[model samples]
Target chain A: MSQDQKRDAIIEAALKRFAHFGVAKTTMSEIGADLAISKASLYYYFPDKINLYAAVLLHIIHEAEQAYGPLVDQEPDPFKAMDALLKHRTEFIIKYYNVISFIRSKHDIPEELKPVFGSVHASELSRMRKMVEKGVASGRFRVADVADMGSLLFECLEGLRMMYLEQASSFFPTPEQFHNLLKREQQLSQIFFNGLTV
Target chain B: MSQDQKRDAIIEAALKRFAHFGVAKTTMSEIGADLAISKASLYYYFPDKINLYAAVLLHIIHEAEQAYGPLVDQEPDPFKAMDALLKHRTEFIIKYYNVISFIRSKHDIPEELKPVFGSVHASELSRMRKMVEKGVASGRFRVADVADMGSLLFECLEGLRMMYLEQASSFFPTPEQFHNLLKREQQLSQIFFNGLTV
Candidate 1:
């Protein structure tokens, strides 16, 4: 295999392993075994276990960024664009639950590796900023302080996403009443627009 | 020490050790050592490590219940009752961050002890429900679905408390803000109450 192919294999294998076991307990040997590569070959592609872990995380974040990147579009139809972006996000959560969990719990990750992670993180906020600007411009969202709104909205959505992942079986909103797959996407969209409105 | 005193000491030691180092790593003998008791003597009070862990959790929960029980009265004024209950809960969090964190994480808590744990959980919910009923009765609050509103308001508060705990340094919200602990709380609260009338 080519060097790049080997590196890619190592990252994909490591993500699968790390998602299940977490980075602290996952070992170089286990990662190599998952890739069906010799430990020596694994070391050749990535200098160390930490480096390999960073690559895996960066790949996961990059993929997520691509999934939610549409939110940054300067759409004439702001609400529709938002609807699409958030729908995309909810879909991603349902599909890539493990990757999202890893991203959420990345505090244990080294500061040096955050640059790789920052690429995706920056896009999320930028996307929100664009969405808020569009909403304000179109006179649909009557809110000041995009900076605060963007940050708070991100955290609220993050909380909802995490809560859904953590306690889906226990007390998840029923689609018929609260929200299901289709209805959750709808509720989240409506909640953001209406926003504690009387 | 007498048997009851020794048991309390052991449970206290478990709380201290578990809070510092987490549950699985802290051995039963380590707690016994902290309590100045022998392993056999510790076993005399609680048959096993899990049982001892359960005792520690129950003790903390009981302590909190004792502290907050009297505040949960069915008051003539809902707002007053809610204000008092939340104040009591807020104090408990400030005073016993460790024990609350331990309970929140479900650290060392066994499956069978869940029902006992749940009663404590129900009491907390009952207080929120009372507040919602008062809001509806007073007509000061918009009433669409009181049950959902009660739960969502509680979740928002829970989310706020957790954010304050986890990211307090990142976003240092002060208490005087009225709606949220953040600087924007006052404005946010006004917007929530009065709507976008401006």
Candidate 2:
């Protein structure tokens, strides 16, 4: 394989190991063994485990951003666009449950990952801003403070998304529980959207 | 002191110790010592540590119910009543942060405390129902499902209240963080209340 292809192969193998065993438990040698690469060869591509972990996270974030960007940017109806975005977010969170949990295990995000995470946050907020601005322009939303409204709506939806995670007996929610969460989100958002109407 | 008054004193003493040290660490002997009573005397009023813990929790719950019951029932304006109730709730949660954290440590609430907790839940939901029903009757609010809307609004406010607790670096919020939480609640509620209006 070419150098770039080898690096991609290593990242793909590391992602599964990191996701399953967590960062602390998963060793670099195991990751190398999974890819049939020598430890020295793995070290050539990434200097350390933290760097490999970052690569895996970046891979996940890039995939999600690619999926989310078009959904938020392209939808004609602002409310529909937001609904779609939130729905996709719910899936993304669940798909990356272990990875997210590992990141959240610490009180703060790691220094190395902060910039990437911050950029993701900034872009999400901007997308939210765009959708609300669209709504206001269309005369569909009568918002007093567009920025505050957009973020408050985001917070409210985020809270709904986290409800199951905090309250459930299991580490992850059952399918039925996930359905209930989305149902509650829909119900709450209907009232919230109505409040924003002209 | 009379028997009932002495029982009350013991509960009062236990509350402070339990709130500060948690139920597991706060011994029955220490609680009795706080009140200048013998361990036998303390057990005369309550059977064991669990029983005393229950009594202490009941005492706190009763005090909160008394404080909250009037605010929800007597306020003429539904939105104002809810606002007042939520503000009071934020204070209550902060004050009992440790106690509540202890309760949440368990996957399910202890079987012994379930009835009392259930009653409190039932009353809170009923009060919410009453406030929305009053709004609907007065034509101040427009709601399709009164029961569902009241609970949904309650959940939304609850989510906002928990925002600081879940995100804070410290176990309990600092004063400034507390202020910000209430501020965000007011902002979010304004939009939510508007959605419910005629």
Candidate 3:
């Protein structure tokens, strides 16, 4: 494999280990072994565990963007695009809540790594902004500050994610319960969009 | 003082101590001493520290309801009432985030005491339901399930509280920063209300 391909392999392997065993317990050797590479070779790509973890998070973001990017581009209705985006985002969150919670609890993530997470959030906000702008342009949505409306919608979704994570232990113990919660969230998005459109 | 008056004093004193020093640190004796009552007498009203803590929480809920009840009832516009309610709630959460966070992390709050918290949340949801129904009745809002929309709004506020607490250390280090967050939350509520109203 080429150098870049090897690095990508390392990240892919590390992500699975980290997700399964959590960050603290997952060792570089295990990640390297999964890729049939030496620990030294892994270090050549990532330098340290934190770097590898950040890379894994970035990879997750890239994957999510890839999944939703086409839907955002092709959906003619802005509201429907938003609904798809939020549903996709929530599904991703539910699937990865354990890893996400672990990362959130760990305060040791480097300041430099923050932008990796921030950029993903920024990208999501920009998508929402574009949707609102499109709705306005098409005379479907009211004329308001596109940025503020986009942000409002983004915060609502953030709130939903936070609530879901908080209640995951007790309120949403069953998959059926979680599925119901998502349905309610979809209904909420519809109401919010209805309020925006003429 | 009358027996009821004495019990009220104990609850009031306990709330102050609990709010200031947190539940684990506050002692029943200190609460009694603050009220110049015997520890036995204090226990007469609240059998244990847990009971006293629960009572204090109930008191806070009652105080909040009293503060906002008039506004919810007297406001002519349902959207305005919701805005007032959310703003009031966010302000309360900001003031009590530390206390609330403490209670949440402990996770030992008794099952019986669950009703105290649940009732407050239910009351808030019911208020939101009433507002949505009012808006729809007046042709101000699009027809939607009132209960679901109310719960959605309530969840959004709950999410805001969670996010604020999570970001308190980094995103909101100063009172001014927290104030700006509240202002942004208010703006979001306005947009949400605008979407609901015709």
Q: For candidate 3, what TM-score does chain B get against the true chain B?
A: 0.79
Model 2, B115-163: lDDT tens per residue?
7666776777677788788789879888889998778766776676555
lDDT of 1 by residue, B27-130 (tens): 88898888777889888988887677777777877887776666656564554565556566556544544443444433234675677667766765666666
Candidate 3 at residue B119, lDDT?
88
| C-alpha local distance difference test of each model | 0.60, 0.76, 0.73
lDDT of 1 by residue, A76-162 (tens): 565677677766655655454544344434334467577875675577767766766777777777776877777665554444443
What are the clashing pairs of model 3? A195-B195
Q: List-wise, what DockQ does each model earn? A: 0.11, 0.52, 0.50
lDDT per residue for candidate 3 within A1-198, as digits (tens), equals 999999888888887877777777888888888888877888899888888878888888788889888887678788678778767876776665545545543234487578887888788778878877878888898855888877777777666766765676433234455576677667656666776778
Clashes of each: 2, 1, 1
Model 1: colliding residue pairs: A175-A179, A175-A180
For each candidate in turn, the TM-score is 0.57, 0.78, 0.77
Model 2 DockQ, alpha carbons vs. true complex: 0.52
Model 3 misplaced regions, further than 4 Å = A15-30, A47-51, A70-76, A90-115, A170-181, B1-3, B15-30, B47-51, B74-76, B87-115, B170-186
Candidate with the larger TM-score of 2 and 3: 2
Residue B91 in candidate 1 has what lDDT? 60
- Native contacts present in each candidate (fraction): 0.02, 0.63, 0.65
Q: Which stretches of candidate 1 lie over 4 Å from their true place?
A: A1-42, A47-57, A76-82, A97-134, A139-145, A168-189, A196-198, B1-85, B95-117, B138-145, B168-198
Ordered by DockQ, highest first, the candidates read: 2, 3, 1
Q: Write the per-residue lDDT of candidate 2 for residues A1-198, one digit (tens) a residue.
A: 999999999988888887787777888999999988899999999989877877888898889879887877888688787688768867886677666566642234677777776677677667767777878888899887889877887677666655555566445565566667887887767777777888
